[model samples]
Target chain A: MVMHYPNGQPYRTKQLSLKKSPYPTATLYGNRGMTLEEEINESNQYYLKQGIAVIHKKPIPIQIVNVDYPKRSAAVIKEAYFKQPSTTDYNGVYKGHYLDFEAKETKNLTAFPLANFHAHQIEHMKACQKQGGICFTILRFTSLKEVFLMPASLLFQYWDNQQANNGRKSIPYEIIKKQCAHITYQLQPKIPYLTYVDKLLEQIL
Target chain B: MVMHYPNGQPYRTKQLSLKKSPYPTATLYGNRGMTLEEEINESNQYYLKQGIAVIHKKPIPIQIVNVDYPKRSAAVIKEAYFKQPSTTDYNGVYKGHYLDFEAKETKNLTAFPLANFHAHQIEHMKACQKQGGICFTILRFTSLKEVFLMPASLLFQYWDNQQANNGRKSIPYEIIKKQCAHITYQLQPKIPYLTYVDKLLEQIL
Candidate 1:
């Protein structure tokens, strides 16, 4: 059976349903259920307030073709078109190390889909890694209520193998659990992903 | 006399008109007249291709209230409202330095207006500077056709002064020219602002 989103979009689901009554939603509507994007954004805010790390989500670029000057102070965008982003979603500095990452959520229970990532994002991550920055992807299995922070090195390895006609389209959940750190959620911080980041840094050190 | 933009927006001209249209009027909208944001974005692309930097403009967060899912692939944002950004516009890593800055353009001729910047942006820049990261502003005087790279330290000095009833709303053009390096436009690289960044680094070194 296919699980349908509140917006009526069909999604892949596991045998165990994680669906629960959605109450106390965000100010944003379709965001009735907390999205991985919102959770991470909130987590970044938490990090910033504590002076731990400074990361921010890049804005989606839109070409404002036409604008209406309704008043001198307020310029309303009348006609605009979205542009494809050329970089990862989140980036900043943490403990003198430049950090860059993209966060994605998939409903698939067995593996994370390759299609969830774009060609440019992989290329951008490769470029960041070359520059000696810590680059990674935070993958979330929404159906399983699990999140994993996978390094870009492993991601690039899998991505290159896929190009070589390898059968792996998605990373298996078991492999992720073994290779990546799982993050827990908190109240004010929401997604306490950075706690895992500290652990990852300790391992690297 | 007030100078009007090609799009009919009134601007305060800093100097007398030097030359009339030598080229045909049709060339005005061609490759020569890209917006400051577009130029910077293109320059970032150039930096990425060269494996030099990985800067990206932060997306303006929007509170998406409603969306129309006509197809499974296409989710159209129907009802949404803009949210205030919490950090600087542009951020990334360049030569092991964490770079963060905001690009702003104004029509004011006498000085760069302080009101163009927000409170959170100032606070964010201060935080980045405290961490020994490179933080600055790329200020473009559209009416004067001039751009300058002002360091966050100098910016914060003026920003703080404004709070103490300094009575200065804009930074004088002479001070900017004396203290900050000017950026020239180029074809493929667009803004070529990072050349000024090299000079800034030289001063620090």
Candidate 2:
């Protein structure tokens, strides 16, 4: 059995990032040993340092039950539990637009399972959309090594259909390929999704 | 021994929110026994529910060092520590603009101390401001029960002055009153800050 983080990254992958890469500057796909979250984090760092954007992954929510304070050391949390996030994983300002997104990679090559998303996340995105925020998903088909930036508006259609029991449990890859902007991974940014965000802004605004 | 959360919220004040108020709907100033965080959360809830804005307080960041997974039970975080946040407390979208802010309450009557802010938070806000996001601080004078929304641009002037070792360590109450927009406590939203955000939008844009 494989454990997974609340954000949907595999628990085993956490250690992979710690392992020093033989080729740290590898631009080749699948050679970097980087998870989607790590790649995005690197990209965010690049964007921030380059003065391109200011995006951040919201820290995982934890319910601290007990804490211990030593004589002179930093306080230690003795007991706590992960709390389900009420919103998406990532959000920040980008070129005057409110950018919000969740990144998920699926092993399934044919369809992206809707189980990766929670109802609250969809609802949160809808509320954000109503407020004119640029909401979307950074979805990756891991086996295929393909990624796409799917607009929240397009996501809502599938979500509503699923909720109404009017569609399949997963979105077919074909539809995703049609409706979403395919993002190619790059060395500098890892994932140049913001270029698509610029396209999204033009269409929506 | 006073305990403070990483966000600067008092530990004792945490229990105050759980107490059943005799006058739940009391509009009297400081009679509700609510902290500035609680009030801002209430206002964000109101805004989110009313489709007014999609603001939310980022959860306090924690670094999980160990976890215990018992049989058929939720994974318990056995070891963790509070991490200094890299960004402001509250951030989200309002009418297409990215809104970022930190909320701090001062007991001092004469001035709001600059010590409440972290350097990284100021740096983050400056970056957001560069992206054309509406960044500010929601300052509360707890003793006087006054709230003010000071724009980040104005804050930079004072922050830079202090950093240069050429100015006072605190912004005087009179200066805050003059430079910031005063916000009044209200029943529904608790803190009617967005009304001033609209005005801010007009001025900035």
Candidate 3:
């Protein structure tokens, strides 16, 4: 089903279909057609139930201007505007470590655009890192049908380079595949991203 | 303005008039009609702008079951339900300290109702305290026209008492005034609750 915004614009679901080949497909369930946000939200619920992590998507901040009060019981928001959020999408605690991250999907097969990220989000991640929290980004390459957990440190390098007039504003897909670890999905755990986190923790320790 | 929930119930706004008259009558304007939530939010923005702290109110969780897409840029949520939140309203950092709090207001002239809080919220606060974070509740008595920064440790005692069949489920206004520090508002820092935080930190240190 297609979703339209208030302005009647179609909302794009970042669901990529994997090519059926002799080799194992990198994308998980090409037919499910679930958006990245929905899948991640489900994964978070799974994580919460298993007593693993308690990450959650921050609600889209809206400036509520007017409301209609029909009765003493119910209040209906009559007018509101979406406000730009100053932080990343998800945050919570995992194994005594504060986890924060942003997930983005790109259709380009060769590179992932840096413009998908906001300056404030990058600054927030930097602050989180300074506070000894685990910060990262999940980048999904739709054309290649692959997803990788890229550390915020690596992301900052590209972000800083872009400010310094770097040749390209996107990180090449090859670099991500080689440097970052892949998160697999399981029945109970759903998003097995914590396994990669365990590895990152091991390296940090 | 009236805001209605999805269930067609009018959302109740906590009134903020005080009756005890501790300070001068002129100061009563500051105490009139401002919710504990609104005060704390303004305080947080003050803290953020000064680089003194970084705290934010978490978004209300909602479960969207269906959506209608009319265009590629917007997704109108057609069917959604509010989900129970598992954490406190506000959380972030202040001087390398993890700060967490829940803001509550009561209209009772004699006491602050314990029922204004939830079991899960108390549990979350306890958990954060166990992890060495500063957790507290900013309580406002609208009828009494007063606000108090009650620590989680003190709050837990009252919460525990309620479960033990204590007939009194509310904290007396006199007890709050004696035990917890009262917050005064400033021009820039509207809530000025962090002044109480400084005292708490001193005691902890």
Candidate 4:
């Protein structure tokens, strides 16, 4: 979902856009622009265009309360609210594999916070994984400009331990760097995440 | 994406609802109450609850133009427009099968019109099919209240032949009745189309 601005930057987090803000707050991804979602989406476009993969980011579900339909015109949504999605943000077929994952960006440098995810997303991913789908999470360290694709199973262990009252609220960045595969940012594809998926395929075969 | 109205009807195609219409015209599925999208969504819910399958309709993508943010409250979308979806609506893991399909309804008794589909959707199903995804289209005759799941390959043949002047613009009702497996609607699942998929899997094995 690339919303191109005059600045030539992809608008992924357009809600926080200063151009649309009458009540301005601190920015999220607007400072440098080109969010992880934007990059990954671009990469997905490249993957699809080249017949490499067919991944897509699931759109956020919304409840429409009011609509205005003009005669001989496209309908306009007047009132709506975002609803909590039951599944992860991204999913599609990748080389005969059903690939599913969620991408999250955290400003925290020390660790990736678990609070970024919802319980349903975890459950959905787990279900997909159980049914032979390849599941993972793309974690983007915005401040660090580092991205990693972490296995869903590892994230689940940390999530399950949360109920014990002794579990860490976040996974250490060091652990992520050690465990997950680093994706090299490419010029054309932007975020070359599928190379890591190729490695997963190798492991599976 | 169940948009439940007080009528106990699932709110599929609710965004295009014409209640606020200054110019009142004929309605789509909203008139009769539950849409084919609704029945399929209801069936999907049943499937998820029973651990039979984990299918979900993809959210309709929207481009938000203006939002109002009151202090200390969730933001409200004031203006937005629906974006044309790039792929099929429903997809998920079904008995380890990567299932992907689109659902449509036409009141025309004699035939199901080919104009109901778009070029991009055909390309998407083809790509998914090439990758061994179980691709199909759920066709519902609203007047008859009958449903059939037609394989993408069969649909593709009709779609490709449409370029030729001699090709038919719509598939005859009799052809669908003879070629596709009929879905017997039941109380629990409402639209139990997956039973036909089970038969397809048997053919595969």
Candidate 5:
């Protein structure tokens, strides 16, 4: 049966579910409209092709409970469940520096919520940061058509504050605009995120 | 239905298939009959606990299809297929340096076969190497009870030579014994692989 929104527009469950997909799908046209992960993946591919960087979105972890093997055919997974990943969704090497990050999207114009990140993911990023890997988050305000690369250190401050008794649940949009590295979209590479990563590298070195 | 091997021992299809499973399974014993991936995972856990290094096995890439979303219950994947990975199996950061590697085990005592590696994996490693990321392969001779970390540069040489006509199909056991850094199994970490990675770091530095 087809579903509809309360406003009378048709609801697309498949597209909604696929938008949460962990892997990138192919796009035939220029960036007409894509999710944050898709944009980063395309930019990563461009960087890889140009020999500027080597990065990839890690595959979603699935726990397989049962599989079927038939004669003269490939094995088919009959039962499985999505397993939670211990690390962030994206990681790779760039110019001899280890880069790690998580991408997030939100429609709210006032702020980006901290609940979008998991506690374990925060711990993982903290561990990577201790190892000197450049860690950050790619934040996209889709309604505002803006993106920012916020360093992990700044994020930890907010996270720790929220864990305390009285802390704000979200980061103000004005704060992100002032503190983070804003990435302008481009034609060839789409996101041009590494330009900001290079900036982070300069600060570190 | 039960089957038997040539030596009259009952065949364990599940264990045989599980041996080829990509993700590591838990073990209660102290390095008692674990696969190469399991040992590496255990050692990675130890390293993570000790703040020595941060490494993880990339989850197996799965192409999920036809999920059933029952009300008030977790979604169950009804059908899916395994997708070939474009890069190596294991990668992470160790002391500010990027590490990438593929782990393989063989029963042949003479050599490790080149067929075990995919063409795109070699290309991925080359891309990583050009970016100055540390790349290598973890090879375990199951029958010989030996493990070695062979540099990706060496593996690439063999790979390219084999691509040309009249090249040997495997790296000779003697060459690997002489060229690669051998890892000793330990009780605490199970397989102390990163000690050799530190050695490789010494050479690179």
Candidate 6:
């Protein structure tokens, strides 16, 4: 059954559920359409085609509430909601190293709010790190058109401080600029973050 | 709206859609209740808690059709269908090495059919292998209650030969037993395949 709104828009339209991402709303980061995640996705495909790396964004987990099975056609999920993932958005292998990271964009001028990440994500990164995976966060300051890769170890210090009620709720951009590598956007593999990965490989190896 | 059967069973029940997996029907392999996938999930959870590995089965991606908003509680996914994934079911880091594999079961006593896998999954495994990740498939023979971890390299050889129309469509049990490590079942981890992983690591490192 089709549901029509007072404005004549159908409730069953595709646009409704596509907007639901688990991240806290950052209305200040006004994306005209494409998100940082989209760019990384495109970049990952490029990397794949060039045989540079094999990273991928895992699909968002959903809790399905209802589905309808028709005789001939595919099954239809009629009711579902997104679930919080236990790990980060992207992970893969780079030069025999296990790579994992999360990407988030903000319009904040002075700081990248640590609130953008969840506790479970922190735990997951720590777990991966313990297993020898390189884990980090990719922070995009949209308004500034700047991206930075901050190691999970550094992020944890601040997160731990926040939990102890002894520090700022976010990491100031100045520290990020000082400590993290600035990721410049490229045309083919737009997020060429692996250039930073090359440097990371150098440090570890 | 509520739906009811002639016997008065409610349509909003969870039993309907939970049965859907993209694999071709293998009704001949009767499952008492818990499946091989569920067992691996349990084992993965056990590994995670013990800090032994950081592996996880990727969520089944769904192409949603319709959703309903009830004004209270979570959003309801009204219609959705399972989508084919390009990669294997599970991937993660194990002691600094990237791990990727798929789990499959068949009742066939003589052989494990290659038809159980898709071309895209093969492509994905090859791509991951190129990036220095370890790739393999976990095969279970239901009637024999036996499981084996066959490296993707071996699987690829058979797949390539089959595509060239020069090999058996399925891998014979003798070959699997001779070539792959047997996965022993245990109580705590249930499918303690990581024991096979430990052996593989010994061979490599």
Candidate number with greatest DockQ: 6
**Regions of candidate 3 where Cα sits further than 4 Å from its true position:** A1-34, A130-132, A143-145, A198-205, B1-34, B60-86, B127-133, B143-145, B164-167, B192-205
lDDT string, candidate 4, A63-89, tens digits: 777776558676678877666678988
Error of 4 at A27 (Å): 13
- Tens digits of per-residue lDDT, candidate 1, A5-37, equal 442323424322243323221111123223787
The DockQ assigned to candidate 1 is 0.22
**Where's the lowest-lDDT run of ten residues in candidate 5 chain B?**
B24-33
| Per-residue alpha-carbon lDDT of candidate 2 for residues A74-192, written as tens digits (9 for 90 to 100) | 66788777667799989999989899999887778899888778889999999998888899999999889999999998889888998897687889999999999999989889899
Two-chain DockQ for model 3: 0.19
DockQ of 5: 0.37
Sort by lDDT, top down from the best: 2, 5, 6, 4, 1, 3
Superposition-based RMSD of candidate 4 using all C-alpha atoms, in angstroms: 5.1
CAPRI band of model 4?
acceptable
Interface RMSD of 2: 9.0
Candidate 3 Cα lDDT to native: 0.68
Model 6 per-residue lDDT tens digits across residues A81-200: 656678888999888889999988877899988878878889999999999999988888878989898888779989999999768899999999998899988888888899998887
lDDT of 3 by residue, A1-205 (tens): 6554432323444442343334222122212223566667788878766666656677655444444433333334444433466788777666666677887887788888887788898988887677677789877776676778899988999998998876579888888888888776567555678788888888775
What is each predicted model's overall lDDT from 0 to 1? Answer: 0.69, 0.80, 0.68, 0.77, 0.79, 0.77
Better of 5 and 6 by TM-score: 5
* Structural similarity to truth (TM-score) of each candidate: 0.76, 0.86, 0.73, 0.86, 0.86, 0.85
Q: Which lDDT value does model 6 have at A140? A: 88
Quote the positional error of residue B182 for candidate 4 in Å. 0.8
Provide the lowest-lDDT 10-residue window in model 4 chain B: B24-33
Model 1 C-alpha lDDT per residue in residues B1-205, reported as the tens digit of each score: 3334433223322231223344432222211223676678779989988888888777655444443333323334443334467788788888777889988776678788787788888999887776667889888888999988898878888889988877687788888888887888778687887888888888875
Candidate 4 - chain A - TM: 0.83
Greater DockQ among 3 and 4 belongs to: 4
